[model samples]
Target chain A: MPMMLDRRSVLCGGLSALSLAALNAPALAQATRLRMIWWGSQERADRTNKAIAAFKTAKPDITIAGEFAGWSDYWPRLATQVAGRNAPDIIQMDYRYIFEYARRGALAPLDDYLGKGLTIDDFGKPNIESGRIDGKLFGINLGVNSSVVLYDKAAWEKTGVTPPSMGQTWEEFAENTIAFGKKKPKPGYFATADASGLEPSFENYLRQNNKALFSADGQLGYEPADVAAWFKMWQDIRKSGGCVPADVQALDQQNIESNALTTGKAATAFAHSNQFVGYQALNKSKLSLTAYPRVGKSSPSGHYLKPSMLMSVSATSTNPKGAVDFINFLVAKPEGVDLLGVERGVPASTAMRDQLTTKLDDVSKAMVEYIAAITPEVGPLPINPPQGAGELAFVLTRVSQEVAFGRITPEEGGERMVTEAKRTLARK
Target chain B: MALHSEILSKEGRASALRSRGTFRRILERNAAGYIFLLPWLLGFFGLTLGPALASLYLSFTNYDLLQSPDWVGAANYVRILSDDPKFGAAMRVTFTYVVLSVPLKLAFALAVAMAFNRGIKGLTLYRAIFYLPSLLGSSVAIAVLWRQLFASDGLVNMALWQIFGFEGPSWISNPDYALYTLVLLSVWQFGSPMIIFLAGLRQIPTDMYEAAEMDGAGKARQFFKITLPLLTPVIFFNAVIQTIEAFKAFTPAFIISEGTGGPINSTLFYTLYLYQEAFGFFRMGYASALAWILVIIISLFTAFSFLGARYWVHYDE
Candidate 1:
């Protein structure tokens, strides 16, 4: 009797569903469907999908499809899709990519669409202007982020060593690292990953010393002596066994998850602050964030607040209006911001920042507070990197490895880097 | 057979003229067979040939993937051949890899095949167990496994320390040893070639071995004078295929190195570097140029093998 009832119920439900679909076919066909893509951890993707679900609930007329990928796979997948001229309606852009894509006319300009197709009235001027290429808006700033030193608080305690203070100098940090390494249980464990060619921290070091990675005209801005000095400092620490041996660290290829720090071979590492949250999630250790180690006798500040990632529309999107509306929902709406909180970084919109700061969790609140405290120390953001700028870090890593291995001296590696930098920049 | 010949004239005089669309006549004569072949032909033309031709065109241009390709003629080829240090390194590494891995893997495969060829119980089960790595190898997961196996604190080091009372260098990371680890990985997946060798071994008539035994030819003597000479054709086939496969090594290096081809570019296989140029650096034009060069190199190697085979490959014919 129960089986008969189940069969009858299934038949009746199927007939009603078919009739409903047949009745609403035209309306479904008329629905404005949009696609969006971004790259991050599963946590970010899940939070983002929830916000998009809210948008769906808020606007029944528009249907949205979403795709997300891990960081390493994202650029290749997106480039392939763009080359096929099938780019999604909305794309998540990095600060480094805005100029390249905008120059290529791949990103849609949002100047005319502001307050019409999209809304950025509440966004701060500095945040709004960052997306501009040649005085035209090409990306919408989603969040402002910066880099920090992520260290395991437990590791520090276990070593009986104090954390590097906020204004710790490079000399002091190296001494601290040596002390930390001495407390480790194993012979091979070190206090940190090798930091000679870690570009973000190296950039901060340069900036603190009144230099930048690239000049306004996209040339190597630092003197070879400056690069040599930076390399020498790390070389000294490496020789003192203050950091993981070069080959061991190179084994992991500087990926945050697999790096010596996360594998319990180090106490401190440099990463973007947004990644701090993700790092903590993977690293079961108690973690804390601090400013980049300062260059001795340099400026008081070296850090810059960077746009974590930005939202942009494809120039060739068929549903431009739908794309803008979705973008508007993501960055400007209360419902969306409520779900998103500060997962991306601190909100770029001033009002949203004020509203969400109090509601964040312990770690997220600490991230926001860390950024705010460092705000006074940070200088203005540097210009977006040039076309061939992406490969510069690789050159730095390759040659620095040579220095660590004693195949070349620091001075020679620095000169090699400068020469390679010039050759690389010339291609742009 | 009747239908196949029916399409041709008795005197075959039609071959002198009206040769255009001749394929259509042959195709129509065996329409059922043609229908059967349509899927493979479609795959060849649409999937393989189309991209291959497109890459040829791209090789002559400067394409950044973000913008339309700009024609640059021989500029890409000139740059890769002359200016790029990593290109030379990758070529050196790939050639070294192929030269070392091909001979080692084939030798191991043949040795194992001979071992299993003796009358052994559960022969089928032994063959299956040995072939498992060939089935599962070359996948990204297996590459990841190889990385863990060779890690500083991984099983390899543990074994070395416990059993040999020796410390192992980081196999996958140390610049001096990274390429050799990948070669060992290639050698480990010798099951496919071993199976082929086993088949070739089985095909040698038992009576020949009996005759050699009666003549008092020892095991090693028989192996050199009988087994190897007759198995040259299979050896040639396996060597050619393995060399080409080694030249295209990417996944193991990519997974093991985290796609950066690092430790001072020690494990930067040719395909990995090409992938980095095209996808990582957006230098599709240069990458396409590299791809074409790889094709030519492989083709030359295959041609060289076929040419060299005549003297050594003693076919029964």
Candidate 2:
């Protein structure tokens, strides 16, 4: 009887011990949640998710939440968030917006983090410098980009027109466009698409003319005649039936997929060479890249290498170390390069670029080769324009519209631009 | 003798106190009613009245939202009126859009309402079908869809090629045709007016129609003499509201033109230009001036509408 009673007590104690262990299991485990924000398409999202899973495997204690949007909505939303003083720890930034946000004290400088094992030597110095503002590193460039003219190979063959070779003059370009238009003179179909408004395209022109949009002193750069000539060229293109009309250019900017070149209505379009990856998904026709047209003096300084976007850490971030680690991975890690592909531009790291090429499809390989072939006299990327720069963009649009509507001559429009630009610069 | 005098004085005081108590009760009841209205009164004071006054004050200053405002009295207004050419162009475009679109939309609404009022079968189905456009009309998705439909190689051009053997112009992209396309889009979503007209039609007395029928009046004649007069109040209401909405239109311009009001600024509406200044240009003071101008213009137009309504709008005695 005594033996049986002792056995029953042991069994009861064992069951109670098991229950206690079960109750304490959750207390031993940790919970950590992190949020990340970016702007990109479904493919980019998928690759990012894969990288997030890999990150989770390395650090099982951490959890990541992601938010994303298209390019248009992303910056405005991010700006509002920053103004509200509640931004995400890590943000995917565009090159245009890097300086603006950094100057506003929204982004954290990465010098300290670099001292603590976060250098991007794997990425080249020129690529890394693209994200600096006032000598402080504010962003990490994932790749490089330059303007290239993308032409439809099939359409060029049909029209019996040769694509513009590297260093082609504006005269040859106009002649080819007119010839292509004559071959296929259908409504809504033209030889060439609209030129880019300001940004890289305008800067390209200024550099070719041995001028800049802003002087070394950061004031209005060019004479009014330069703008007048640019407007005259567009007007001539529209009048000669070598390009889509003003109205069509308006629609092209609205829905990029509906642009004349994308719909096979035009022979060529202007875009970053890196954009070929994005276009490959949208167009069924094969696209090939050529250098931007030569103008004025046509020196190597006319063209430039630019970072398409940068990844930056937020000033308000609680996980500055983790953020820097992620940026370093984006720039230095082979796996991160594989995930990003050429979406950010050509890989900044030589080894990463070499490794990525064997696995990359036709478009990325071509972009790498195109960028490599250029002479190294590329000018330093321009700083983000001042506060009233947005007004200048709108004013340019208005001036162009007035010229197109015949409300004003191109010369008058040029004068209007100069006046507005001065006013905008004064506000700055 | 002293006891009698004291009792008489006490009785007189009590009667006077009763009258005072009754007066106090009336005051308390009045206070209760005001207490019931306090929430809405507070909302008006806090949200609407405060912002309206602030916007008015802001119009006289150079405010960029990021820094303290500086007083620059009348400069913003003067620049908009005289120096800014785009401002004048935007005004002209907005006026043209409002004048053309409002009347066409109303006529379409009235016609559609009349057809539905004929005791047709599947009335609910038809109403739902007509109402779908109004529900989705102002959405960015609809504007994007419109861009595709009216694009250079869109369905409209495709059908034109098959039927007419001639290509159509890019309707939404063309500066000459873009405003007309917007007018057409506004006309397409006439469901709200049609619904209001339907209700007004129901309120019309059947006896009047019966009397007209007995007098050998035709359907069109009865519509003019009886239905038209009865529906005037509803039509007037819809017109004022729609005119206000037309003057403030922004989404279509933003989405269809990608914020350039493009194709040579043919689609540049007034509100869009204001947005460009406020957010794009960081000219808060200038935008505030523009807002006040819009408010004044809308008020004048509304006043004109009410003044004209005396000639046309009819009310039952």
Pick by TM-score: which candidate is best?
1
Please report how far candidate 1 places residue A291 from its true position, in Å: 0.4
Q: Positional deviation of B230 in candidate 1, in angstroms? A: 0.7
Task: List, residue by residue over A1-428, the lDDT tens digit for candidate 2.
Answer: 55555888999999999999998777645635556789877877887887777777766766667788876667656765764567888898877666667776778999777647476776666776777778898988767888777888777778888766687877778778778778874555777885634445666777777777777566778878888887787777767878877666666662346556776667788777777787777888788887777673356446778887788888888778777776666667787778878876887778888888899877778878888876365677665455455456656766776676567888987898888889777853
Off by over 4 Å in 1: A1-25, B1-24
Best by lDDT: 1
> For all the candidates, what are their Cα RMSDs to the real structure?
5.0, 9.3
Error of 2 at A180 (Å): 1.9
For candidate 1 chain B, the 10 contiguous residues with the lowest summed lDDT are B7-16
Backbone collision tally, model 2 = 0
TM-score of predicted structure 1: 0.93
Residue-by-residue lDDT tens digits, candidate 2, B157-215: 89999999988878898888888888878888898998998989989989999999999
Q: What's the lDDT for candidate 2?
A: 0.77
Report DockQ per prediction, comma-separated.
Answer: 0.62, 0.31
